[model samples]
Target chain A: MRFLSKALVITWKDALSEMRTKEVLSSVVVFALLVIVIFNFAFGASQEKMLLVAPGILWVTFTFAGMLSINRAFIPEKEQGCLEGLMVCPISREAIYIGKMLGSLLFMLIVEAIALPIFTFLFNLPVLSLQLVVVTVLATLGFVAVGTLFSALAVNTKAREMVLPILFLPIVVPLIISAVKASELALSRESWATLASWLGIMGAFDVIFLVVSFLVFAFVIEE
Target chain B: MGKSYLRNILSAVSFLLMAASLYMVFVYVPTEATMGIVQRIFYLMVPVAWLSLLSFLIVFIGSILYLRKKQSRWDVLARSSAEIGIIFTTLTLITGSLWARPVWGVWWTWEPRLTATLVLWFIYLAYFLARSLAAEEHRGATFAAVVGILGFVDVPIIGLATTLWRGIHPGALIFQGGLAPSMLLTLMVSLAAFTALYSLLLLQRISMKNDEIEIKRLLGLTAERHNTGDR
Candidate 1:
């Protein structure tokens, strides 16, 4: 109970801080929206063609925006030197890892929540479905799970911004592939059975990485 | 024999095996019934592919050992193996590309094995990049070990995911099947030669890393002595 509460508190702390400044949220949203617009212009994709390409565009934007947010995930703590203070606290390191992951996931979800409607409105695609939403949530959870871990790893590196993306993207290729596939099936209104395989992959990836990241976080964050 | 002598002998043996395989691939092995001499590139590509995967597996082991023991020697081993893995992986991709150009009729294709190798290449390149870019010197090994472990775990996932994605709409068509006895023999010899070569490169690189560390240690000691003497 103590561990759980402490993690929740840490998560709450992150959320409250973000709510106050809204720095990560605003930039992520703007960047995501810009990606959607650019993909629109770059591909010259029409509505009919958009459905075919929407899943790829959607994931690319989400991933890029997610990477952006993660690149800064530890910045405030790092800059203010509160990271050491937090490490010295009574809480277990695992709680800090979970808390940061939750905070990051929450921020990303907020960005996606805003971006999805706008993406739909512009592309005129039927992206606002229950299945699509489910797939999006599952995929984003897996992404943020790994992304948070890498962010911690990257922040302690010489060239943090460069370190994160190259290290991050290759590792999460599986997740992206699964997300794109599931999103494609959901958008096409395919049978639930077809989407189930992809969802299963996402679920398995989430479970494995959430546990792996948590276990490894204690090691990676040690000063 | 001394370690140096053994290493030199191993190096010599590797070269011999490689030269012998080259001759076997070119002359001893019969041309395939379908594709002619271009098929001989298979000998080069397959062995390199095998050795590269093995090299990465060595890195994974070395990394886990480093994390467990915190031994700088393990770190050296892991980094050197990664260096060798990248070299072999590059060879694998280039050879695969050459074979694909002639056989598959395209300069590039997203075949499962080919794409998976490309992803593995990126993962290890990232591994090297992460090693160099780690914020602190000692922390570099630990961070890289974590990535090394994760990157190896990712190999199967990538293989699975790429297969899944390609299942919906197929691309990058190519054929792989049974081989003749002579061809298999040539492949065996070539793989043995590449394995020997990997061993040679790994030993050389590891010793180089050790030497570099030794030099750094001596420099640090001399600087400390200068400071103490000045006081």
Candidate 2:
């Protein structure tokens, strides 16, 4: 219960800050929208003929948008030099990590939520099914699990902007593959049986990453 | 045996084993009937790929040990192993491509195993880049260690997903055949030789890292002395 509250407090603090500033969320949402628009231009006429590639494009947008948010996940703490202050808090470092990760996850999911409707309307793909939503959540969960950790790790590096994506994209390949496949099945309106394996893969990846990331969060948060 | 003597023996044995493996690869292993001599590349590629995973396992173990012990040596071991592992992985991809070009008739295809190997390569490449670019001291090492452990954990999952994706996507090439005993024997020997070589490379790299650290320490000491003397 203490751990839960500590993590929630951190999450609540981030939520309040974002509500006020709206810095990271606005930029990520815009970037994600831009990616969709660009993809439409590049593959507009062809997409109608072959909607199969739509899932790939959707995921590409989400991954890039998620990257943008993660890049700034630590900017507020970094600029204010408040991570050190957070470290000094009575709560465990794992709590701090959970807070930051949840904050990033929520921020990314909001962008994803906004992008989803636009994506479906623009691409005219059937992506609003329950299975797709679950896949999206699982995929994004695994994504931010590592993304939050890497962002904190990258924020301390020299070339942070470059380092974060390099560190992030490779580790999230499982999520990308599973998410894209599951989305493809859902978009095509395939039966649940066909999407089952992909869902299983995403679930396994998310659980493993979340647990592992939580365990090692202290190492990154500490000096 | 003394430490230097043991290292020397290890190095010599590693070289001899590699030579024997090469000879067997060229002379003993008959040309595969279907793919002809180009299939010979599989001997080298398979073992190198196996050892690459072994090297990654080393990095994973070393990273965990460093986190537990907070020792510089463990960090050195992990860093060196990651560097060498990436090299072997690169070789694996290239050789796999070489074989694929003739056998599968394409230089590259999104085959699941190859795709997984490619992703593994990217993860480790990112590992080295992150380490070098990170802040000095435990800041970088600790973060890289965390990434290392997480990345290792990610590999099998990614491999499975991609393998399953291939099933959904459907590709033209599918082969399930038994290997001859002679080929299997050669593969085992090649794997052993590659393991020996990996050990030698890791030891040498770690020693070099130690020397580099000593040099850095001495330089810092001199700079400190100069500052004190001027005061």
Candidate 3:
């Protein structure tokens, strides 16, 4: 219980800071909207074609926008030297990792929530279904699981902005694949059995990477 | 003297094994019934692909040991393995493409195995990039090691996800009817030859890394002495 609260304190710190500036959230929201708009021009030729491609478009926007958000997760701490302050506090490194990961996850979920309605209205897809919501949440969890660790690693390197996507996107390819497939099935209102397997893959990905990233994040942030 | 002699013997053994495997693959193993002559590349390609995975495993193990021990030798091992692994992975993709063009009618397909290997390639490329872009040597090794562990752990998940995404039966083409005895023998020889070659290159690369680290140390020592002399 104490550990959970300590981790939540870090998450609350990030949220408090984010609420004050709204820098990461506001930029990602705008960037995601732009991606959807551009993708519409590029792929929106016909109504039928739009439906076929909608799930892929949605995930691609979220993936890249989520990259942008996660990339900023550690930069503020690194810039202001708050990381040192956090490190000296009475908490394990794993706690800090989970706290940061949840912050990014929450931020991404908010961006997705805001984008989904506009996307449905623009693309004419009923992507607001419960199944799609579950798919989005599960897939995004798997993504943020790995993304947070890589973000920490990237911020420590030179050319951090360039480093994050290269390190992040490849690792998250499986998540994107499973997510897109699951979303497609959900949008089509397919049988639960077919959709269940992709969800299983995403779930396995989330569990494995969450544990692995949690274990190794200390190495990345260790001075 | 002793180290060089052992390396020379290893090189010689690798050379002989490679020559014998080449002869077996080209002349001894009968032309496969279905794919015929093009199937010859499979002997070399499969072994190279196997070594590529083996090299990454070495990187993963070396990274873990480096973190635990904080030893430069383990870092050297991880770095050397990653450099060799990337080359072998590139060869795997190219040779796979060559075989696929002749057999699968396209130069590329989103086959599950092929896609997984491609993702593996990207992950290691990012590994190298991270290593190079790090501001300090120890930091680079530490960061790269983290990537090494994460990359290896993700490989199986990537494979599974790709397979599920496409709903394709894995390796349906390669092992359809299984291999003939002679072909299997040839494969065994080739795999042995490649493994020996991998060890030979790894030994050479590790020695080279050691020399490089030594030179850097000596240079730092001389610079420190020069500063003290000025004082």
Scored by CA lDDT, what does every candidate get? 0.86, 0.85, 0.89
Which stretches in model 1 have alpha-carbon errors above 4 Å? Answer: B168-175, B223-231
TM-score, every prediction: 0.93, 0.94, 0.95
Which candidate number has the best DockQ? 2
lDDT for residue A26 in candidate 2, whole number 0-100: 83
In the range A70-162, model 3's lDDT, one tens digit per residue, is 887898788898878988999999999999999989999999999999998888888899889989999999889999999898888998878
What digit string (tens of lDDT, one per residue) describes model 2 on residues A1-223?
9898999999999899889988778878888889888887877566555387788889999988888877767866887998788778899988888888898889878998899988888877777788888888989898988888888888888887777888889888888988988898888888999899888988898898889988887787677
Show model 3 residue runs off by greater than 4 Å.
B170-174, B223-231
TM-score leaderboard ranking? 3, 2, 1
- Name the top lDDT candidate: 3
Ranking by DockQ: 2, 3, 1
Report the C-alpha lDDT of model 2 over B1-231, residue by residue, as the tens digit. 375786798889888888888888899988889889998898888888887788899889999999989999999999999999999999999998998899988999898878989999998888787777877967778877887898888878877877788884333323246789888888878888888889888988998999999999999999999989875
DockQ winner, 1 or 2: 2
Worst 10 residues of 2 chain A by lDDT: A44-53
Clashes of each: 0, 0, 0
Candidate 2 docking category?
high
Model 1 per-residue lDDT tens digits across residues A1-223? 8888999888999889888998778988999999989988887766778888889999999999988877667867887898899999999989998888888888888899999999889988788998889988998898888888888888888777777889889888888998999988888888899998788878888898888788778878998
Residue A186 error for model 3, in Å?
0.9
The best-first sequence of candidates by lDDT reads 3, 1, 2
